[model samples]
Target: MQIGFFAVGIGPSADPEIIALTARTAEQAGFHSLWAPEHVVLIDQYASRYPYSQDGKLPMSTKVDILDPFVALTFAAAHTKTIRLGTGICLVPERSPVVTAKEIASLDKLSGGRFDFGVGVGWLAEEFTAVGVPWERRAERTREYLKAMKLLWTEEEPQFTGEFCSFPKVRLYPKPVQKPHPPILFGGESTPALKRVAEVGDGWFGVNVTVEDAKAKIERIRSYAQAAGRDPGKFRFMVSPGLGLPVELDMIKRYRDAGVHQVALGAIPRDAKGIKGEIERLAEKLVVPAAKL
Candidate 1:
């Protein structure tokens, strides 16, 4: 299985120099990809319950500097040759499909086709409200948005007419280098999320899941794929075991056995002062060893 680093490119590590160094270090260390999360804006208070945490709270402070994932990945792309850059989970429903499609295609083209579009229908109701997207039908909207983006990416003169998105036949330039566009990896662990993956996603991105849970979830996703008449083997599964989990050989093997195509480990440095050392140690201790096996 491939190993990747789930980078929190925001907060103290948001410096351009640090981002460049991390990407170069990860690429040289044999990591398959460098994934970053997205949060366009954060509210001071919210009623939304974060699903990954035990107490349903966001892990980071609200004041943290969350960078735009695509822009950050674009910078990383300019600094590295091989390591793939991905948005660990881009909130699709909150953004315009047309502009987002252009950004995705532009990033893919400029990065030599090294972009993975991991997306979700977001959980923060207040944020969604702030962005002017109704929370009630966000999932349906997200699905339609993905469809709309695909049309723009594949067709020479693309047009889309859906409940949430509609546009006349118009030409979009700089089509993505990756055939049929970059891989669309959907993130979430709920049943609807799994069904969405089977229906539209190129892969499944499971977050905060254990080995045993991953096994079951993969099986369910495969079953859903079969139900939808899609080959289960064509889909990929990636998991990012919640932050602070031990990254060891046995755990890596367990994830591989559970059908994970890639495992993304949280590489949050203790602080900006120790970023380089942390990257080297994570590579030497976990990423490099895991890649060899």
Candidate 2:
């Protein structure tokens, strides 16, 4: 039963001082990890439905300044020692795999091997169009790009050939500090997403699932893994439960009972002092009690 916060570098906390303060405070308060969300650019008008909300619109404004997850987490890495850092969901089809691999390897090296790679195919069709990446067959492209990145991370003479990505034997220096690259946690709740978990994921990251949803999804993932000859026991389960806004211990107990390994919370405060106070409150209210659970 570990805990993490959704993001640090956005809105009022986007400043360098605030990012450092948030990271240091969370680590000191006994939080296990810090995560950051990513969106290359938000369109003022888009038709893509935000999966997490009821009105088919993200609750955020287009004016929100979302610092790049890598840059933000790098700030966190330099500021804190023990807190693990992650991209809550890096949209895979939007960037070149080579560039992404290098960034991830560098982050892992700098962070002392504490990086969790969370990835998703993406939901915003318009954003993909604006980024000049195809909106169709993106999941397939995501699968290919990730495998290509794997070759870059793990192979001595890395090479890959696929519909979306291919490279001749080459070298990438400072391969990830983790043995075989950082553990990739696949995000999304679609059937295809679960199948992606079966294909190459080290874990399934459920966004906004309930206790029952998490349980059912975990079982489905297990079955998918077994069907794919993957050992389900080795896969970690992380959930960003949609339960309590000010999360409750009892809600945590339910998720723990459902076999969730880590609970990543969201809607954290945006200002420096508010971030510190929230971490302190969460540490007192949930971190201490949940650790015992």
Candidate 3:
């Protein structure tokens, strides 16, 4: 099992220097990855429910100071050599695929092939509207955007023609360091999302599901993969622990047994000493002996 940390990167609580230090230290401490969440801006009166929480509320802290994920990851990548840099979930439909693909590919090139592109179709209606995207067609748009991105990543003189996007053949420079592009981990729990992951993505990045349910979800995802003519074994399973603080090693082990390849604990407090202590604590309790146990 690969143990990792996920930070929201709230500006006041998380400084760039501290974020970089945390990434470096996580690498030194034998952690597998460091993930961050995205929110370009937050509107208090969102007309959508936050999927993970019972209340449809965005955390006030997150809304107040969320930093841009790509820039933060770029900063963290500079300070760490081995730890993989990831987005817990970048909402893709909000931005143009061509530009987003270029940025992500650039990051992969700059990071020496250590970028994991975890993505989602976002739940907040206000957010999609704010970005000038149609909320009703988010799922379809997400699918098309990902399909378009795949073309951008793998093709030479890539061209895409679709309902939402169209472009003539154009070459994307500084092709990703990772062959065939960086690993794409799609985030969502719905059937449509799972099907999308099975058909196009390299992995499933799920949120808010417990291990017991995750086991069932993985089985369903495998079924979808099979139906999509994909080999299920090639797809990775990654989870972001929402609302929960640090989880127990035994619980981590249980999730592994249930088919989780990577586990990331989110919303960690960002004080340096406190963050270091938390990292060491998780390493001692979960990661260091995770495989042996």
Candidate 4:
């Protein structure tokens, strides 16, 4: 089972030095990947309820200097060689897909084909409205935009036509280093999200699910994929069990038995000052021993 690190990478204490240090250490420690979520701008009043939290309140960390995922990942990419970078989940419907495809494909080219595009339809209604994107038709828009992005990445002279976007054949220089474009992992626990995974995604990324709960979800996902004539075994499972206890070996075994491909440690640092030390401690204590099993 592969292990990864999930970090917010914001706040007063998360300076460049700290981030660099963490990235270097995580690479040295043999962590599989590093993931960070994105929020271009946080909105206070949104009609949609925040899904992760019980109270529908966004975390205070969202209000911090949360660096843009691409820019920050580029900086980290310059600093590390082997450690892959991913958006734990990027809110795609809120941004222009053309712009996003260009940026991410460039990053993938620069990183030597080490990029995973994790996407979601977004939860903040006000953020979508602020960006002039309708929240109601986000799913349809997302599908169209992603299809357009694929055309841009794969076709020499790409063109796209859809309700949300249409473009004439155009050349995008420095096509992605990855052959078919970066692997996309769909994030969310909803039925539509599962269907999206079956149709378009390379993997299903689960959040806040225990091993037992995840097994059921994975089975459901596989059923959907099979129904769509997709090979269920081709779909990877990447889990981020947020705000949880230290991952035990037993938990790791459970996930492995249930066919989880990777697990990102979502236990966050309570003290930003000690984030590095905390991560090192967890890696040494939990991950190292489990890898041997």
Candidate 5:
């Protein structure tokens, strides 16, 4: 099992010096990847349900400092040599597909093809409303956007005409260094989310699930993949055992045994000093054991 981290590039890690230190720390510590979450805007209060929290509220307040995932990852890419980087979940429907594609391709090219695109048709309806995106048919919008982006990355002379996105033939230069494109890891645990991954995702970024839940979800996703005529063997399964899970060797082993390619620990303390300390500790306690697994 590859040990990675979720909730990177938030709070103090948004600072340039701190991001350099944190990114290099993870790379040197043998972590597999550093994944950052995205929320373009946050309101003090919103009615949208936060699926991970019991009270249907976000863990963060509007004052929390969160960097744009692409910018944050690009900064980390410049600061590190080998540790992989990902958008733990970029809100796909909230951004333009053509612009988003350029950002992903640019990041991949700049990062030497080390980027993973973990995306979601976001849940916060209020945020969507704030961004002027319709709250309805978001899943369909995400699917169409991804199709358009894929064409941009893979085709030399690309053109896409879809219900949500359309563009004329154009030369998209600096194509992603990754062949075709970087891995598209769909995020979420909903049935539609799993089915969406089966249809288009290169992987699944399951959030806030335990080892047992991870196992069952992976199996279910595989079934969905088979039903969709996709090869489950080609898909990567990445899980984030929530903050409450024990980050012990035995726990890591159980996740590995569950066929998880990578297991991500939840966000650490938000301060730069705290972030650095926690990652170093997790490196010793989790990365070493996971590598042996």
Candidate 6:
């Protein structure tokens, strides 16, 4: 199984020099990809609980500096050659579909076709309100937005009309190097999320699922794919464990046994020094040995 570092791209470690160093080190260490999370804006308090944590609270402080995933990945792209860059979870429903399509395509073009678009219908209601996006029917909007983006990516003079998005026939230049756009990995654990993946996603980015549960979920996704007349063999399954979970070789093996194609480990550090140390430790102790096994 491939291993990736899930960098928050926030807090003290978000400096440009640190991000560049992390990208270079991870690529040199033979890590598969580097992922960054997205949050356009954060408020001091939120009614929505973070879904990944046991206490439903975010691990980082609200004061932490959050960077735009695309911008952050762009910085990392300039610093590394082969390590794939991904938005761990871009909030799709909050942004304009046309602009996002251009950003995804541009990033994929610039990154030599090594972009993974991991997306989700966001959970922060207050943030949605702040962005003037209605909280209700967000999943539906996300689906429409993705469909719209796909049209923009694949067609020469694409036009789309939907409940949330409408556009006239127009040519979008510099189509992604990867045909039909980048690998779109949907993130979430609900049945609806899995169904969405079967319908449109190239993969599932399941969050915080244990090994035993992930096996069942992977089977379930395959079943859904089959029912939808999609080839289950073509889909990728990836898991990102909860923050603070023990990440040992045995745990990695469990995920591999569960049919996961990749595992993303959170590599948050307090400062630039810690960032380098954490990447080195994970590379030497887990990623390198795991690859040989």
- TM-score per model over all chains: 0.97, 0.98, 0.95, 0.94, 0.97, 0.97
Each candidate's number of clashing pairs is: 0, 0, 0, 0, 0, 0
Looking at model 5, the pairs that clash are none
Q: Tens digit of lDDT per residue, candidate 6, span 253-281?
A: 98998999898975676777887888888
| Global CA lDDT computed for model 5 | 0.87
Candidate 2 residue-wise lDDT, 1-293, digit = tens: 89987777777767898889889988998899998888988999898999998898988789988888999999899999999999888998999999999999999999999999999999899999989999999999999999899989998898888998889999998899998889999999989899899879999889888899999999999999999999999998899875236578999999988889999875546677787887888889999889998
Estimate the overall C-alpha local distance difference test score of candidate 4.
Answer: 0.81
What lDDT, from 0 to 1, does candidate 2 have?
Answer: 0.89
How well does candidate 2 score on lDDT at residue 2? 96
TM-score of candidate 4 against the unseen true structure: 0.94
User: What tens digits encode model 5's per-residue C-alpha lDDT throughout 1-293?
Assistant: 79887766777667787778778888898988988889998887777888988888887667878899999999999999898999989999999999999999999988889998999999889899999999999999999999999999999999989998899998887899998799999988989998899899999998888888889888988999999898999999998877646678888788878878998884645677877888888888889877987
Collision pairs in model 4: none
User: 154-269 in candidate 4: lDDT tens per residue?
Assistant: 98998887999988989886788887889899998999998999888899889888898789889988999999999998999988777555677788889888889888884445
RMSD of each: 1.1, 1.2, 1.5, 1.7, 1.2, 1.1
Which pairs clash in the backbone of model 3?
Answer: none
Could you give me the TM-score of model 6 versus the true structure? 0.97
Candidate lDDT (C-alpha), each = 0.89, 0.89, 0.82, 0.81, 0.87, 0.88
lDDT of 6 at 62: 81
Segments in model 6 whose C-alpha atoms lie over 4 Å from true places: none
* Model 1 CA deviation exceeding 4 Å by range: 270-273
